[model samples]
Target: MDAKSIKEEKAELEIWQYIFGFTPVAVVKCAIELEIADTIESHGGAVSLPDLASAVCCSPSALGRIMRYLTHRGFFELHESTHKYSNTPLSLRLLLKNGANSVAPFLLMEASPEMLAPWHRLRASAAPGGGSAFRAVYGEDFWDYASQNPAVSKLFDDGIASHATRAICEIIERCGDVFEGIGCLLDVGGGDGTTLRYITEACPWVRGINFDLPHVVCVAPQIRGVEHVAGDMFKHIPEADAVFIKWVLHDRSDDECMHVLKKCREAVPKETGKVIIVETVIVEGEEDEYSDTKLALDMVMMAHTEKGKERTFEEWDCVIKGAGFSSYTVKHIGSIFSIIVACP
Candidate 1:
């Protein structure tokens, strides 16, 4: 019987770390639901445990424990001597509002009970002919469920806005040229026009049509220089100089994606029209933070969508060519999403 070396013992502990990976998710979800970061921000950037507990209606000891874990997780900074907690850069980004890029709504949506339910069925969802985890739980399409549940719909829309805002801002900052030379831009599955509002704000000259289902567009607020139009992309897309779809295509299978792409192709001009697709391009053999995120998102797709998963560049190439596009150029924008411009 040989004794384990120090390195071997540390390697053995890695499995325990992996086992504990899901613990923070629940803790963070609880903190997010209580608006812990927002409370700290509202308190002029720091607060004592008792004050935070009072603000959020939690017991001092319980809130202190939560804050202890959060501070260790790099979410908050703890001043040990004074016993005050302050927002770290990571926590500031979780603020509900008055923050540059708030990710609170998106995180909250994923943390909600309904969203978590699908994850519970992940194993059964993998069985032959069992269908998606979400369908197994809800017994309906995601869009249909959202349309039926107003509260869920609102959360979803807010999540989309929160999730897309940072990526859109980065794209506009680095790849603003994509908006130029466009007279009319139609945002497919525009999701309350969050993406359009960002784009039109940057390029005021470009008129925009925010297109989605009637239920979705009905809830969308009116934005200057952007019209909310309701329609089905599978059947017809409103004619535009260019069609823009961000984080939309990955929800459908290849055939459905091809159908929408063809519709987009038909909506634009033959000579110079293009469809701007903003999605994850799964680069093969890439092992990095971005790839890790993309892969995790692929699992999310499996749980949430019926037949959707993140795709490699090769998969994207097949869909683009199947849509009858003459050619497409891939631009690695300074964001996780790649911009694929498919020409008619």
Candidate 2:
């Protein structure tokens, strides 16, 4: 091929990467299902292709192809001379056993057919008066479907909890000061009480209320010093010294957030109480390590919810003001989320 033709062809392939990017996601899901990372880690972080394949009960040739692609994608490392595989830092995070911060469940859920099917209908959902692609494909809202399907509900819960574990830990370490002087804390829409469990454990003096829908509270395991309560956030929230809402508002419209924030304002004392919100705040013209994930999640929110979308600082200010909060402050936590403390 001519030099110019070759250069153009390479550029086109780069563009094609965006079109076929789901390939890596699907492959990662396969690795999770087969516990490939766990298998390799079990063998002291390295294993021959034949042995690894045997442990996973798959054909060596097929598994070899999978490993080749994973290694090419930096998820694993290959020892060329020995024809063996080992876990990279990325792969270690997917290990099911004894691996710190495993996101296997999250990967599994995102790569599931149930989740991917909705993406095909994104254009339709984006049209005016059109609803979520999830609803378009499933004939019901994502939360409603989860309510009816026990398995999906469990997966959803587990996936979210798994993903939140590390983030919640970081928040406590980096922003634990937010809990000081709080006698009672209410976790609005705290699914399964995971976040509160961490908080109450870290701050033993603080009592926590895990508030969510009745069905969600019914399945939450009881934790000492954390009380589980069932109610809608739109209508009422139990009184507390501090009310915490994490990853909830982005799944709602401005009108809905205003309603919930108003309830939050009512739940806390005007003198000292505050509302703590943990979510992604998109800032225009600002680039960081989390920019890509934040933007990608914004799209995911659009595909899965009727009106939910990420907000900027100005948008957040508008909602906080609309809810009658007098002042607020934001602290960026890690790379993906921010902690906004709002006071009445």
Candidate 3:
């Protein structure tokens, strides 16, 4: 009731601004769908509201409101006097024509109804034995739902491939030494063989086996040095000098990952083989932007999959050691993910 107390209360309430922050995501998703970034770029980097709206086929007034919010969020830069808009550094990444590095597909996929619906049931899913919130919302699991819906399936695949193209290219360029002397490399759960193709092309001496579910492998693109093999990873993985599993194990529970790693152990020679895992290893300590993003992804995994989650270094070590690996090394690729090489 006092003036100082009222001021303190108002300051505390400011924290709520970030608590209900879905608006930025929704706005970015809409801009991506409308190709607003690309439109501005195509028009030589700036356009008035009316011109931009005409290009995006929307009402000038409606688009203006959206652009104002986006500009406030730093995604777009608005010229005060001219009312022309240009892409900011943040919005530049949403340009669809940017190709592999463009996150448009990934953002669009995450913002899709099929993906967003799960968050509504997060309370139930977080309960003991409740399983995925996605399942809670859709009656079936995420994978099964995607399998049945062709459009959703393509969106999922394209989104993953877009990210993988950039990440795998970086791995090949910066860490190509990881593949040296490897006679053969098996990419377990390699969807579409995009990563394998990149690896084989980068290291011509290394043969590649693209292994995945039957349905996934059936439509895999033809890559000359990579062989498409269809099978379940939990049951069996093709023999290889080095086994590469990227963005796969995180979709499994500890027990499930242990089973798949056991299969990987069996597939390679005990003395000479190594298994490479690419995944997000949660960094603890300060609440910086990178860690915050990683934490958000952890929630996404929790909501979308049966038992998947982002793990910390200690948690990853426990699973690797439990799978009977004699030694392992962790290499942080960048802020987003890490590479774990485990040897039997």
Candidate 4:
């Protein structure tokens, strides 16, 4: 091949990456809004562009663009002979109505313009003494804002539930053995006890306490065989054989995390108890794409909240041991996140 051809090819690949990357996410959000997956699924298996547009109540021209993009991205498969679009593996996983592990909620939550717009103001938040982009733009903290907005709160909760649906399965599969001996477990900041509920149903002998803010717990529907405790993790955590903190610590500063760890230490007995933390330990090596995604998520945490970012193993160890924990174990759960067991 000629030099110009190779350069052109590289440039084309870069352009495709940039264009297709954002376009598909927007299309995904559009699909959610239009209930496209549900519509197509309801229509047997595949649907023509015209039918899909009719079902979704959008113009055929615009719908064609969205469908074409999705098909190219492998979210939907287009049969060349008949021009029908079928749900691909990606769309099937994202189907909101009856998916085995629906990520629709999380996708919708993050991709919404309200959430995505904040990234634009990230530079301002990076200024000295600046707060998170959420606070800077909305004039209130995320939790505080959610407290007043029912729709937004539900969206956030549903997103967390969706996350738990996928991550909890891996957690149990890889770290299921960790729960074997524990009599009781506490899920700190566990919304609606999704993770705990999954665990309790999996292990009938073990009981769990779902601990969170009073208002959050107040709104949580009572799950069978789980105790709902309303309290602040920084101030206190209900006593349990093992305290589980899933996707919680990354949203706080080192100081705040330490305080939380100290409180967790108080909640469980020293000899037999441990604090199980499910979070990303930003490690070197491994799949470059996966690590980059982890780093991007850390930037999201940093941009959206004060004193929050993903940490490394050394960072976690400092906080755990500083909080008086004797030892800790990092278990690769094979999910997007990992588990850290800290013994007091």
Candidate 5:
């Protein structure tokens, strides 16, 4: 082919990737729904086509197409000689059967009909005065919709709980110093006290107040050394030696974040207290492993929330300083999010 012709063909090829992206997502969702990974593990981590089809209640021929697609996408493996399929390394790590690192529930939540409805209206949401895509679909914001639908609320809680547990544990492990000398730590916007439970368990010396809204804290389970306090963070935060917020600030605008942060600043003792924040700090155009994931989550925030977003470092600094925090330091724990300590 001529040079110009080759360039045109390459451009077409690259555009096709965007067109084909939804197929893998759909196929993977189907595979997880069928419990394909768990079924394979049950058969000693490998299964033949007929056996797998029978187990998941599909015809062999139809299941074969799914298996072919999944294997090619590297979610599962195909043994050339035996013609059996087994879990790939990626499958084992993300399946619900495994703990902590599993993204199964989160993936299912994102692919759900209710959640996907907003994505369809995303373009309209981006236009001037379009407002939130989620609100457009449900006639209310995401949090309001969750509060009204019990099943959806539980599904989202389960999804976030699965991943947040892992992230919290890593923070306690690597950034233990943040908790040192903290007699009482208030977890702002702590849902159901899960994050506070992990924190108290790790640092027995610390007492925890799981602070959130009345409805959210109402259903929280009892944990020793932790008190579930129901209130609005925007209004008032209970006094404590230190305050910790995990992935909560991202769900607000810069003004809203500063509002919450200023309250956090007030809740602690001005002389010795500090606020700990766990959030993603996006670095634009950086080719790091997690940079893309952070950017993707920023897009999710755009489609799903009014002003929620992941912030860049300078943006974070702006909010921190705007919130009246004098200075702060960030520590990365080898995950998509980082731990930030802001001093009063």
Candidate 6:
């Protein structure tokens, strides 16, 4: 009611926003591992802190700090009676083993030291015409490390599969018509055939080829009805009616992407063929919070991997034409991904 009181409340709210935003990322990650969200929900809204700690295999006293932190962040609701906590809608969305928006695996994988280590040298990576952070840290590129290290490779592969499973399912249901009349489909750089499997299942009449490195394909599991072809995309791709380059081009420089696209163009006949590319076309002046996330990803690509980025629609057109394609059609696929079908 008073001017002083209102001013004090406004200042406190602003301070809380900064505090919550900075710390919740770590706490939310911990909650995912502990299944704290599911545990509280299983209790039908509210759960005592002691019971929550017991479910997560942590000492009650030690867990209390994390619980209080999350409660302050609005992920958990604290009850005065028993000092118990309840799940907020935000926490429920992150439950690893369950929930409609299960981003737990993606969070864990991306938040790992292997992925986060590059950020430590982000400033250097952002310097004028710098190389990737992976090269800076490991003295080698991502594919080189993935080929040599099995554990790291498995983690990266599993994380992609987990995210793809959910995302591909939604894409198929929403944009299944895109595959109609597609005869032979080549999945360029298709890691382990996860997307290929989804495509085959959705469009039964279409035959598919899973193309990636020989090493990755050597140990890759067989997917029925889809042929596995391992080779270099820069060299040549097998002939096909349609070439599906999903999330592949973003990991390379403009020259490198042009080379790959040219090779893809050579593989498919212009009159009856197309190259389907799935990636983000970053739009300038976008006001969405996720736009910032896309920019952050672009930096990650710059730091840890080879030249890659979230390009805008104009950039997409320029790159496609640079690769010798006459025109292309872009379609939104999933929340953050887009499908661009380029034809010469």
The candidate scoring highest on TM-score is 1
Task: Output the better candidate (2/3) by TM-score.
Answer: 2
Each candidate's number of clashing pairs is 0, 0, 0, 0, 0, 3
Sort order, TM-score high to low: 1, 2, 4, 5, 3, 6
Cand. 5 Cα-lDDT: 0.86
lDDT of 2 at 87: 88
Model 1, global lDDT: 0.88
Root-mean-square deviation of every model:
2.3, 2.5, 2.9, 2.4, 2.3, 4.1
**Across residues 1-344, which tens digit of lDDT does each residue of candidate 5 receive?**
89999999999998989988788778878888888898998899889999999999998999999998888878888998998899988787565444456777778888788888899888756888657888878888888888778778777776777777878878878878789999999999788788888889988999999998776777778999999998888889899999999888998999999999999999898989999999999876676888779888998887888789999989999999999998899887886988899999
Name the lDDT of candidate 4: 0.84
Tens-digit lDDT track for model 6 on 266-315?
A: 89987988888888778787756567777877876777676777688888
- TM-scores, all candidates, are 0.94, 0.94, 0.90, 0.92, 0.91, 0.84
Question: Model 1, 300: alpha-carbon shift in Å?
Answer: 0.4
Off by over 4 Å in 4: 1-21, 95-100, 285-287
User: Where is model 3 poorest over a 10-residue stretch in terms of lDDT?
Assistant: 92-101
- Local distance difference test scores for all models: 0.88, 0.88, 0.86, 0.84, 0.86, 0.80
Q: Candidate 3 at 226: error in angstroms?
A: 2.4
- Model 4 residue 272 CA deviation (Å) reads 0.4
Worst 10 residues of 2 by lDDT: 91-100
For candidate 3, give the lDDT. 0.86
Give candidate 2's total backbone clashes: 0
Clashing pairs in 3: none
* Model 2 lDDT tens row, 1-344: 99999999999998989889879888888888888989887898789998998999999899889988999999898888887888888887764634558878877777777788889999867788767888889998887888888778777777777777777899999989999999999999888888888898999999999999887889999999999999988878999999999889999999999999999999999999999999999999999988999999999898878788899989999999999999999988887899999999
